[model samples]
Target chain A: MKKKVLLILLLLPLLSGCWDELYFKDLQIVTLVGIGGEKGDVTVHYSFPSVSGGNGVEYLTAKASGSSFSDARNNMNLKTGKVLDISQLQVLLLSDKSAEANIFDYLDSLYRTPRNRLSSHVALVKGELDAYMGNGKNENSGKTQDTPEFLTQLMDTIKEYSLSTDYNVQDMGSIMFAQGQDLALPLLKMSEESGQPELDGTALFNDFTYTGKSLDITESKMLNILQHNTGKFLRDTYIFEVQGREVPVTYEFIRSRKNWDIGETSITIRETIHVEIDEYSVTPVIGKGEFAELEKKLSAAIENDMQKTVESMQEAKSDAIGIGRRVRAFHHNLWEKGDWHDTFSELDIQVKVKVKVERTGILD
Target chain B: MKPVMAPVQMFLLLFLVQTGTFFINFPSLMIKAAGRDSWWLFFILGLLHFPHLWLFERFYRDFKWTKFISLLYGIYWFFAMVSITSYTVYTLNVYAFPKTPTVVVILLITLVLLSASTSKTSTSVNLGVLMLPLIGVFLIFLMMSINNLEWTNLFPVGHMTSKDLFRGFFAAQLPFGGMELYLLFRYLTAGKIGNAKLMIYSGIWLVFFMFMLILSLAFFSLKEFTMISEPIIYLLKSQEVTFAERLDLIFIYIWLAWSIISLCGIAFAIMRLMNIHRVKKPNYVAAFLCIPYIPLVWYTATKTGTELNGRILTYGHMVFAFILPLIVILFNRYKGRKEPAK
Candidate 1:
């Protein structure tokens, strides 16, 4: 037994490992995220735990790009004494200007780089992150957490928000890699009013560039339905006929599933959803058939909203729904011979929606 | 004859060793063949080996000795030399090409493998079993990767065309190349130890395990598996374990061990052939013969060692892995059931 123990111990060193090791303390961790801009310029900024290491007030700033991101990063070393390390980066902010121009070249380098993890969250900002990250203030300051603490929190939010589905680096690649599909990134607007844009909506795409069509939070609810991220809707929205009064109704999506019926001319997408009411500003008018009527009214509204989002995507020539990808998977031979992306937009999408009310949350 | 390795142990060791080089690049190869339908290609390739294995065993049972290589032509041997030479060269580059005396480093490895199997007595069968568990742990690690499988990624059924299916299915046999083990089995059996089902069982194990594990690796990646090169290692390079810097080190380790084992398996065949023919050279000379293939590989690619998974490796694998077995199976069947030819 002693000899066997010694043999195992001795054989271990001859086998593998200990060739190289990097400790976090010995190196500076870069939490900065950059995006490519026009004229081959890359916007650069990074953050680390401000002085004392553990203290949380971090520093983030940007530099204009005259070269690629790596070169700009090399140049940033001149401004700051520390070398830029991006292996620890957790979030990416692409200004609407950059994404509108096309993010493929920028994304390709990052995705191909050995150090990039492909799991980072990416957002399309409505304005310059430099204004806030450069100025450093709380009001209308666009902020994204690059630390593990908020990553788990965001992952939890992924369960609640279906719109957050195409909001990651992997999501961006999926959109770009798929045929005839315009890519959409979550668009956010920063203002002193809304507390630094938190996933304000989605930026639509044509080719790799943004089409400048963004859906607001309400429209994004239905966009989530089209993406089928929220598999079913457990809560319903309040229906109030206010005679031109904008009724505030919040629908909490629980589950949604879409089936695309490929017709000779138009594509029909039938969506079956499960939903329940969460809030409404008006009292319900109790009648014998009130519940059934409300169900029809809500389903109609949801279906109308979903159709609008899907059509917007179709018009943008974006394949974000991955319908073309679906065909490539199932009818691979036929798709190889044909123009998949063009055929997809010509697809007439007709939607039929179904909803089930679970409950009005605590009568409020 | 070398001591007989247990059929089960040989199955696991062959399954792990053959995959050591192939799986690291399987996702890309499969994707290229089947597009999104690569997993089905892996499954079908595993099944295709069954008929081929049956043909070899039937030929072995009648001949009562070793290989069909002697009956095959001198020019066919040119392709055979080309194929084996290329595979051996590629395998050597993976572990020790740039760092050492390129030829000398490969020769040392070839010697280590030859030393283990030169004995005709059933002694080093234990070595095959000993390496099984260590390699099995790697298999289990790949399976552990399945826990991260995304079912939605495999969305929309029947995605690959019948043509893509044919192409991808053929590509998967690169990992199944060690089916030459029938040659190994014939020597070890020395007589009838098990039935044809031994071959059947090994085939079934290889096909199913690769189907599930390779499929999961393809499906678990963030995007459509279209972007990955050297898919398996690229997948690892993407993974982080809260602390570990790069998971590819595990891949580097597996590649090294597998190269050693495969080189041993190839050497075992060569030495046994020299014995059957009554060649009077030392057994060690047969091992060194594969050494010349190393320089051939260096000429084919850069000496920088950065491109282990490049075109040269794939093409060489095709010549040896697909073409060689394909010819052996064809000629063995063509000879029409010889009576005690061995």
Candidate 2:
């Protein structure tokens, strides 16, 4: 009994949790961080929940500027009453100006800090970060859903709609460093009408820096399809010409299989998509032959649009489809030729999309 | 002394002692050395352990523990334990407790080692059995990172140069460092556990390592293998479970506990050696053995210390664990035993 008691006494100090023990009250959790400006001059916006006058918690946005992100964060720490902790940070917004610079440089501090969360959502914002991340009085400032929660939910909603790939801050490192593949982040712009941040398009990046080119929402959806990044609901409306009249056909994607055939200098990407017809306004008495003809027309239209999407990406010099990755793995001779971005821009790449309408909703 | 430990317990000891400290950084080293071809090299190197085990098993009965051989093993295990404890402290400081002093971390680890070393060898052997279920849980959680794996990263397999192959083989030696313990134990009776059982046990251990290697390779990009020092921890850090946000913290603590136990296993071996040499009060001697290591371990908590420790472990493992044992076995097999003490 004496030995047991002595052992307990010996272990009592260890139970105090030592020097790194951080109390919750001492830490002000910053849920959202916005980074802007170029390498030498950087600005960071930290948004944290603050308790006010016996009421519920209200979020407050604080801004700081310095030479680098760490410098800005350190400067911000001086202004805050409590230690500014980003361990629970939900989203990181990068401005267009910042995204134009080397992305890895902006993110290196976050990655190096062991306490920083890597699963946070990263998005590219249009214009200055100050406009999007206002003083948190969003309701009075003619803004709707400008909060970080809304932004994260918007990104999640887009992911469900198959408009963007589910690449977080951690996953971006893989794509950023990979020689064969490039990274495409979701682009956000404050809606002029709603004064809320909206999914503008997808930002195209060549190597580590932004290529100053982006694809619109429709084109971004197409890019997601080509990359096989289909989420739960991949619904799209396509214009089909039937009997000299253009009719809109809406389809929900079921499954897709992509096969890439690479030659010496040319590559052909063939995709077979199984879809369910959600909406077809013009209901012609379709037989099996007519249905086959419809499939052929749809395939040709999708193929043309997909080909245009590939051209746009190639023009931007962004291999977001990981075609270069496939080539590097299988075709070593071509991979060793030159820089992947340069080789990708010059390659003869073709897209062939085949759509098979498995179901035509409940009406059919 | 009679062999009190069961054959199963001894095998568990061997596996835990060889791999506990190694699993933290072995994947990164292997991937950095060989890239996509790391898994292939690991397979070949893992298979090579069988021949060495066979050689040890054949000559082990004839081999006798002399004062010189015992002293060499004692010194090697002592330094090995110190190095491993230092590395573990370094890891804990980086991930779990950034503000904790290296000496404090060393103190806590050495306290556990001191306790285990002062006890019977069976006490340390039984600790391995209790960890089996947790190891299974750890493995399943590691597999949860499969959702993040990019299967295409495993391609370009045959691109490793001769230099890379040589480096990969050298890096692969980290896990198999203390494998000479298989002969040292002698408690795993030859009658119950033959060559086949030993091979199967080793194969299971190798498969566990290969699974971790494959997950790490496919999970991170080739360039990331160079940047991230602890790919396994980062892999776990990137993963999110339903209940926990930071899975790496839980696993790191578990890994730290396993490391301490493995250190205890090493200390137990040194204690057994001392006791065999008829040293007075072997337990107290083993306890005193850890006192000097605190300062040494604290000094080696830096990056340079980490690199120095790595080189020592690699070369020391090659010379002391493999080459020396093989030479001693060969000498005993061909020329017969110089010191016939049993």
Candidate 3:
């Protein structure tokens, strides 16, 4: 009798057929999700692949407008036969218009759901969502490649080139709630030349809202270097006037380091970059003294650019460089005295840059 | 009547028990209380466990008062066992199996506890031996997560004020409460001197605690650490390895195994205190002891239940694990001196 009972208990799990189990075939895997519109009436775009057996995967896009994100998601469920599974969601796109207002309100659903992928890449779209999604389709083929996959690959390639920092949902959450740091997301725009979406630069955030200001690609690279987020190589080309002629030199970053010194009334940020000469339009037989002068000019230009970036960020009240975090960590009293955002805007901040030409590309 | 463990087994058992459910959310709780100084608070409170170990060891050496001390320990074990089991069940429900009914999870855990507790003590020690590899896997996962660590997160070490440090110490003491199981199982190390074994075990515990605390603090910023419910699991989530994805799910299964071993240890302690080991049907007695815990476990797995559990652990550990042990040692010493004169 006991043996029989044990057998029955063993078979019970199989008999249940996993009532709570979620099967892949029964789930609509959302690859990309876009949030737009204003606070009360938000529009969400879910881009997924419509797979039919024996046929090629076709990209399908859906839209739902509701009072809240969850409501919009539920409304989307009414339009689909399978449950919307965001566990495999790859990219989250927030339109620039909605992002300028407040993104945290729309992102609450993702944050509250335990199963949502926190590692999903988050990007800021520069223009209308409809236009970007529409242009995302191939013109002649009449079939669209997956938007999220395309965007993800584009961002990955850009990240390898050290163009912008890869900000994910988890990083966004951390920066959003973090006291001393603001958020920075990759800015995506439709390329006028190719009519394809391309990473333009970085979108800055103050608190939970976009600051309506962004850094250009060069300034973005400089900011990344100061934040110690540079990839294997960062290419920078600068123009300097030497001997009454415009000299263009390109430097590939070999390595970089940054240090911060916090004081009572001021903060000093020092950056050092080691570069190998990739291209130099100047004469190869330039003297050593001339090279030193070139290096000084390059350092000053980089410092001036970084100083402007920091000043712009301060004007926007965005501390994406985490100067406030450093102050909170090392200067707790100053952090506790008043609002960090206010103090950061008015504080004496200094930027110093040093460039070392480690290799001259066999030109000596 | 005889010691069941060699000195080494005693150490392993103590280590396993103390580490129960600590890998779950202890770091978050500490960060919530003391901010960036949570790791320092963890170190300070972990050192405080040594005196409590000494008191328990001193109290256990007097065989004349063994029964009374065993009774107090048994009662303490009952609460400690409930807390540990409930925490494991709550975490499993929250993280792994949210849809499964609370009763079913509790019953399944209780069934495992019954089978393990009814068996000989060596069975559980062998289970502890199996845990060595699991612990190694956990440490490896923690090591892999170092690439994502921001070491500056642990700065401004003494930023927490005295009151905040005090609160953090109390919160950190909850995980160390499981170390008190050593008193209940002291018979296992009967022939061994207490000091060396105690120091070795406490030292090992201290090392593991420091490793986990430092890793957690470095893995997330103070604000992020405070906001997260389980910083260690989230830390593992941040670790994207080539071989395995979603390491947190895999790590939780290993954690569940460790929790089972810990639960079995607690169950056996309860059985020993109840004289279930001497019964003809010890398995039945073990099962019976688990009955009252089912509803209690169900309660603790709820939202309000966890809050009450935290409060109980904060105050209860200080009294039962710390203060009460000190009082018992002092009283035993006085009684021992007076009895000889009488």
Model 1 misses residue B238 by how many Å? 4.7
Q: Candidate 3 chain B — worst ten consecutive residues by lDDT sum?
A: B333-342
State the weakest 10-residue window (summed lDDT) of model 1 chain B. B71-80
| Model 2 per-residue lDDT tens digits across residues B1-342 | 456677777778888888797787889999999999999889988888777777676667665677898898888888888789888988899999989877777887887888877876668778887678889888888888876778888888898899999999989988888877766686333345578977887788789789888888888899998789898899888886678868889989989888887887788788878777789988778767767888889988776787689879889888876778777877876876643323
DockQ of candidate 3, scored on C-alphas against the true complex (2 decimals): 0.45
Per-residue CA lDDT of model 1 for B1-342, tens digit only, reads 443556655555455445544555556666677654566556656666666556556655343233455323222322333343344455444422423434444444444555565655243344455455666565565554454444444544466778877767666655665565564455454344355666566665566456544554444442455566455555555554665665655655565666556555545555555565566874556455545545543444332332343334445545544566566556656876543433
Tell me the TM-score of each prediction against the true structure: 0.75, 0.96, 0.92
Interface root-mean-square deviation (Å) of every model:
6.4, 1.0, 2.3
Q: Is candidate 1 or candidate 3 better by lDDT?
A: 3
- lDDT (CA) for every model shown? 0.56, 0.82, 0.77
**Model 2 per-residue lDDT at A100:** 85
How displaced is residue A144 in candidate 1, in Å? Answer: 14
Q: CAPRI band of model 3?
A: acceptable
Which residue runs of candidate 2 sit more than 4 Å off their true CA positions?
A: A15-17, A53-55, A136-146, A243-245, A283-289, B187-192, B338-342
